[model samples]
Target chain A: MATTSRVARPRLSSTGDALRPDSNGSTRERLTALAFIAPALLGFAVFYFWPTLRGVYFSFTEYDVFNAPVFVGLDNYRALFADATFGNAMLVTVEYVAINIISQTVLALLIAVLLHRVTRSVFVRSIVVMPYLVANVVVALLFYWMLDAQIGITNQFLGWLGIEPVAFFGDQNLAIPTIALVNTWRHVGYTALLLFAGMVMIPHDVYEAGRVDGASEWKMFWRITLPLLRPVLALVLVITVVGSFQAFDTVAVTTAGGPGDASRVIQYYIFDLAFQRLQFGYASAVSVVLFVILAAVALVQLKLMRAGESDVA
Target chain B: MATTAAAPLDTEALLDRSAGGGGRPRRGPGRILAWVALVLIMAATLFPFLWMIRTAFSNGAALSTQPASLLPVEPTLGAFRRVLGLASTEEAQAQGGSGAAIDFGRYLLNSVLVSVLITAGQVFFGALAAYAFARLRWPGRDTVFFLFLTALMVPPIFTQLPNFLLMRDLGLLNTYAAIVLPFFFMTPFAIFFLRQFFLGIPHEVEEAARLDGAGPLRRFFGVILPMASGPITTLAILQYVQAWSEYFWPLLVASEENVRVLTVGLGIFRAQTPQGTPDWSGMMAGTLLAALPVLLLFAVFSRKIVNSIGFSGVK
Candidate 1:
């Protein structure tokens, strides 16, 4: 079964003999392939490729919404370096990404472990996954309402315990963390589902062997499951980090980067510059910076995972 | 590939092991504690939606009471009626102040139309491209596929400024085309996902179709597509949900009421409400209405959705 399945796998990256120049069907097959692929390629070029190239070009020029772009080499980057708000946004974004990664990963892993040990029914699992299906705007609005200082149920619950109603979106020091907590609440279920899938992929004999050796569940998980789950853990980390960096929808709905830019992450900052301030060139420069950071992180993650695979092999 | 093969077996083994009663007994204090913790987690996760429902069903006066009611106090469909434009003008004025009436029905229709079109377009084009990449041996296939994969790393925000500028240049702003065109045809993620599904299909089936003198299109439509219904359905649902819930791009391109989607419409409603004295019940009603479709989609196809997520992550 394994060998036949392996043989059946489509080789997407190779040229089969049927398509070689000497083959009788090569020309017809090539024409068919191009016809099949034309629509997607056209859309990709128009939407993705052209925009990306223009974005890079705009990063180097000075342009606003009204006028033509004037070429200025590296001036935008220099101004970005000297800008205080940009620096603050960078710091806040890094902080947000770090806190989000830690909290979401830990909570998701915990839930996945618990679920693996306890539940087997899809119904129970779906209840937990429900929050992830809600729109970001909806989640943000729901939490905004639930955390309202005067009439929110969260504060009401707190008041019953003799605590004052905290303004979740008002205070600068608490706003970013509050948003992070809400973001975590929105995403933890999906993350847990990913990790749960990874956990269930492990072979059963390993657990049987550990049990036969009188290892407790805790020991078995730490000694056996953790090592095997490293690749998936890396995957989860990469995805969450990339997502948190680009987060804008929730912030837009809940805070609009406001109460004096306390929760202004990079994406929101870029939107403010491009749309609100009309500094298209500067926004593109900031976008370039964000792209570099994300690309670097993704490359490092892929390399690390590849190295781990080689070690196992 | 190895893990994929092992996963189904692991599930079966897990079921058999638990049912055969070898490792640990089911009744214990620890087990009870685990169940308690699970239930608590479930409650915490679901509490916000419950609050939305509570607020959605109540009227302004009931919500404005000193302590908010956990249950609907004056249960009325007044907010829904107002949102859907089913209420009379006098009825709307009697409910609340300036923020009572919005063209929410138009927004709902716009959202539905844009989302369905984008989903159908994306799934169709994505499957065509994925089929070519998965089955046909063509020059530059790998390079083109790799290029598509690279788009995954380029943040959507990076392209937003240029795409918006392009829309403005073409005089497409405030039109549904502006909101729908950029994403209507194909996305890198969808193509990649469909390609993976296509690769998993056995080559023998396509060979059989070819032997029967079916053309490439016929083989794809008749042979491959029937086998791909699971992944295609998953992709369609996902794309629909995503297009429906999108906020940022729509907020940029389609700020006009005629083309406004639910998420942006809800945001506009929130902004129009007076700060520190928000129309909480109205905003909650808008949110509940916006969230209802995707939530219903989940209620029906949650297992397939979850499985697709797992497949994407693991694969």
Candidate 2:
């Protein structure tokens, strides 16, 4: 049906073009697009939009899985503010996000710049992406063994340096950073690929112009590549910050938010509240708070990114 | 834009160094360091997976040996056999925890079934939606499409509990439906991806078919789909890997042994450990085996995986 309409359109357009100068070909275009997009729109509405609205509504109500929600007004919200665990979770999450964005972004930028200078071999690119492909569970489990403190390879390596064994995950102070470092290692390959793509899209003429201007390698990079790469960097920062806030599975697998909640991210905290404590209403309230925090942060970052780009321009 | 191409003296010196390509001045220290850094990154990535494989096979007693061997001294299929339940769930059971009772066979079957259904649904329904979005004209098209994009920002955690409630209300909890239904329909990301590829294709190809009287359905099935094979194949591989590795949702939904996926089964195993110490050997064995499908997928299609991520990230 769409093809028939599409087929009819050109002939119709010619007739319309000849007879009616006002015809814009808009109707045919719209119908054809509607046919293509309807299914996606329907599915998105049911699975995504409706649920998102439902989530927000449920945040204000008290309900268990067995019963319909009973409106409790701002009670859940009040308890959320009063909860000490919630406070700790907020602090830990902010710290985690800060650590993740800084470390991962810096490493990704460095690797991307380095890889850009190297040969653009397919094999090299594949090797660079290999770490990102490994499942989070596998990485967490692997690190668990490697950082086992006594029988672990990390301690064994330290032993050779004649240093005492260090419990990487066992110590409260070391736990979050160790996890953060591992997170950085797993993500840098993936992030580098993003930066590399941005690098490749840069026109060669710009680099050549920089070369002709007697720019040093460092100067050329700072002046030419970094500015061109702004969009990708902004993208990486947005996704990284958002992802850090949502960190759950790795902590679940590795630390179980342990060493007394040192590594407990907001997602993990939410999970414990909803599942373990069975505080469905309170968790919903927490989720609402999280949603607000993320939205504010994203909006601010987006504004900053646009402002920075405009400044560069 | 106009300037000298570096100082003539500097270019001449650099060119001379480049000309001595094989011995003392062949590769600069910079180039060597670059290669070294590349090699180190590769090692860092590969080392954990290698260690997992070795540790999975190493005997518990041998693992405790001083100055532990990186390679298992007596590498055995013992762990693999135990995990596959070709030996006995008893060895696993003796090791104790939720794993002791875990039926690896059931979990494997559950994972395979769920992954297959989700992949099939995403390809079929997602293609239909993507095709519509790509080719068919509609009212409020971009507005509606952007609405779908906003769904990406809602975060999975937001939908997770509500969906579970929906499943519970439907009495589909503890069933595969709970795990599969939310993902079975068209997703915004997949729609956007397929639409991007579809938009790049010239209308002339479809127009030619239309002129030859090929129906819309016929053109879609015979032409558009075949042309869109690369993205479809890539999406399938990704959706499969994702479904196979998913932990939290499955844990939340499926409580029965028969419905348990590998991730939840591992979780149960983790929970069942006696005292403070976990059954490290058994747990590692299970964890390694559980990651096998994704590992295999990654090994086979690292390029596609990376390219897809890059593509999505940029968009």
Candidate 3:
């Protein structure tokens, strides 16, 4: 599509072999194309495409590895309604997503605007994104060390301020939020750079026009920059929200849904159900719900935010 | 975050000197405030890493007492030595290590093997599929591409369960193939990323090759691949970092000590140590080693990675 729009001509050769624009050549082209995509197609089928169908099918059955999946239509979904831990997982995941998205988006917006208006230093931006480049497990462990209740650097600093040491991961109330914050610290810079990319695409003349009208930086940012930046912000939100919903790695490494299941996001819960409890069918049901939620979120946000059609020309 | 562009900003003036828009003077309080925020962000961003270095160098026994200090307390190579299995059991215990004979050097090699294999396979197969999607006129082309893309929305857990079952049933568990198989194929993102790049290659480049009686394969190899090398390298870097940082799938499929990649090894290492202030120096040292390869890659390709952040989500 990208090529055809630009070239404005018939294809150089529909037959892959330009020397022979004949029936055999077209057949050869088809075979070549198939060969090109054969590995990906096989992988897609075995790994992705089939699993999606199997997951949905498993939701309707009662299966552990010992027995064949008994056809118990809707049993897993009905079970989920009464499952408090499943409900907690859903709640915890939502809380995590909300915290992560809000904090990350707000901080990233501030950083993006700062970079756009005051500095475009590659050095500064690189520093900001360093945490993101590290593995999630590595980041989680680093923070787990830094925020340990007794000897953590954070608590050590709090002591200097005469503040009570907080149990970042030990307290049930604090575990999820702490996990969210740790991830936010890792992510904020990358998010900021993403928003900055969007900000770069907005024409300078719009800001120039605002300055000509004697608009303060505050007013210009609010009235001009933010409005023109809707599409980009929407994209970032969609990406971040979707990404946060799959918060397994950090939780697995750090809290392990701990401080009394306070941080068991849905993904970890699914792992627990499928692996630890051997309830593969029930886990599949939860996964289906997660799949639906992600699909709905992506679609709804894109629709509401008008991601394709930007406010700016 | 512009984490990798160490080469670009070695000095203090992070502000791009070419920043001429907005008409704000360079010396105002607003500018000063911006610089302060930049400094604070940079400091906050780099602190954990710097602290990782500090903690990695500290004597694990002295870590808790001087946790707030900027420098290591009774600095030693004990942690690094223990994690790498260089320290004897008694020496490891003496330095507050868990005294587990875990070989991090082996895990590092394991990580190298897994990440390199996956990167090579994912990039190569993805490029092939991308070429088909971008350049071919086969029937159902766009539809097939769209089918591949919707896989992205399928949360990994959905596939992860069945894939694990498949791996186990095949009796491939604890082997690299089990872990590598799931990721060795092209990601939807990888395919999409390469396809987008391929589509932008001017047709004439391939047209000349084709007019020389070159077949599709020859055109792809001779013209398209070289022209799209930049995106290919970027995608490879992105994918390598991704494979190196992978924890979830590798954790599930390859749980054996020898097969375990760095992320999983680090997780288990963190788990093995006893609770209260348990040998953080050793763990941080291990963490730093696990993260080193990707960091080195980032240092070399900082701008490339930084430039590609806008399109990133897979990592």
Candidate 4:
């Protein structure tokens, strides 16, 4: 595949040559390569490899940090299966994920389309993404203050319009939606940029050919843009859904899963079970369940979207 | 570099209006409406964000009085003083801050130290591993790199408890080691990112370095790494932002005051709300302090960041 050509390919275009192992696989070369990868491999084996296996292993055993782990085989899973709190958490997490994915994908699509028309300068692009550049805790605190019922800027502004003050985080019914909205504010810009990337990749000749055939802008968008945009939308959905499931900092800082367990999503539930109640085994079981669900969700989504298939289709 | 605070908006030329035939300009009511709606949306999205800066500069006592004011209420630096621990407890309470101190200056230092160490170590080792994968021919090289990539699919929550117990067993909990070690080593994403770049580099130069009798390490440091300064810088910026803004891992292991990073510090500040009203002004000031480094870095390298935008599903 490398062709043994003298003139190199363009600097960024990827080639499949990596799949072909080098012809000279001498022992000295192998040892040198091993040495090169050793430090990273050490880190990978320790932090990622060992910890992941140990985490799953810990789920089947009972350990209190004070004593050796006692193997309890499926008890943690059985308890979690019947746990109402876990059920509530999963439901709440799904509720949170649904709101976040739909709103973020739609809003980010809007922003990207608009910016594609107006300007795409790095300065303007950077401004839109600035909110996303900070920690979730920053925006969480920011919106938490602005949305405060009593004297928050949002409520104060709403009062000018003669509307009653609404409790965003304080009301159980409003808490989950508010969390989703807050994260949307943080992410919509970045997701817009992500969609914009997908838009930029669509070949110019596709649109040129459309215009030559007298296709209107709206017509072109429907026929050309939306179909091409599907894979990107799927990607943003998977990303936002996964991150939304693990939404912790905002919940931790703003509501702390309060207002009567309305905002107690699964990740927060895992955290509380482990740290607050010191039930490490139950928490690990919950994590395994979450991992499985997330993996299944990702697989289902990729399959449904037919990612990496023809954009025109 | 597709890690966090700001990821590779990795796909370049994000808004290439000129490239598309649909970018045609036409005067119409629909265009006007679209423009107006764009302004409105940008306004609604960005307008509320200014509240943090406005509140940070205002005295805490004035927030209750001027909750909706355009200019800062009783514009003062007292809240910042309160966060930085420059004000005494009496002064803090008198100015509507909690009596407990936040000491953001100390946390800022911790954040800088921690973020730098992570970026430096992660980039260096990640680059090495990436080189091996990209430039060297060896047994199981691709397989090993594929295994490293599998770790990217494992969420931080899945490994949270085991890592915690490992740290506790090693007596490193509440220390910087626990806060740093989990990410201090190579991240799969980091390796993947560097390997992609390393693969793109002209093999001619590396071949010349080899002919000069340079060893593997020498060729790496002397030739390839220097040639990769552009991507390396991009990776470092992305990695630094991620390291600085990390919340979950640090929150789990190093919630103690001294080792606390700015994010966890801000959380604690928010949690310590006084009896009546939350310390809105003081907490906002802390948030500003926490966010400044990342924002400043973005401002400095925004063009570099924007030009390097690639979507690798980094979140």
Q: What residue runs in model 4 are displaced by over 4 Å at the alpha carbon?
A: A1-24, A307-313, B1-23, B312-314
Ranking by DockQ: 1, 4, 3, 2
Candidate achieving the largest DockQ: 1
lDDT per residue, candidate 3, B112-213, as tens digits? 999899999998998899888777667677678767767777788888888888898899999999979988886876776676667656677777877799
Give each model a TM-score. Answer: 0.93, 0.86, 0.92, 0.93
Question: What is the TM-score (0 to 1) of chain A in model 3?
Answer: 0.90
True contacts kept of 4: 0.50
Please provide, for model 1 over B234-284, each residue's C-alpha lDDT reduced to its tens digit, 9 standing for 90 to 100: 889878887887888999999998888899888888887645567677778
Give candidate 1's error at residue A236 in angstroms.
Answer: 1.3
Any residue pairs clashing in model 4, and if so which? B9-B309, B9-B310, B10-B309, B10-B310, B11-B309, B11-B310
Instruction: Give the fraction of reference interface contacts each candidate recovers.
Output: 0.48, 0.36, 0.49, 0.50
| TM-score winner between candidates 1 and 3 | 1
Q: What is the interface RMSD of candidate 2, in Å?
A: 11.0
Q: What is the fnat score of candidate 3? A: 0.49
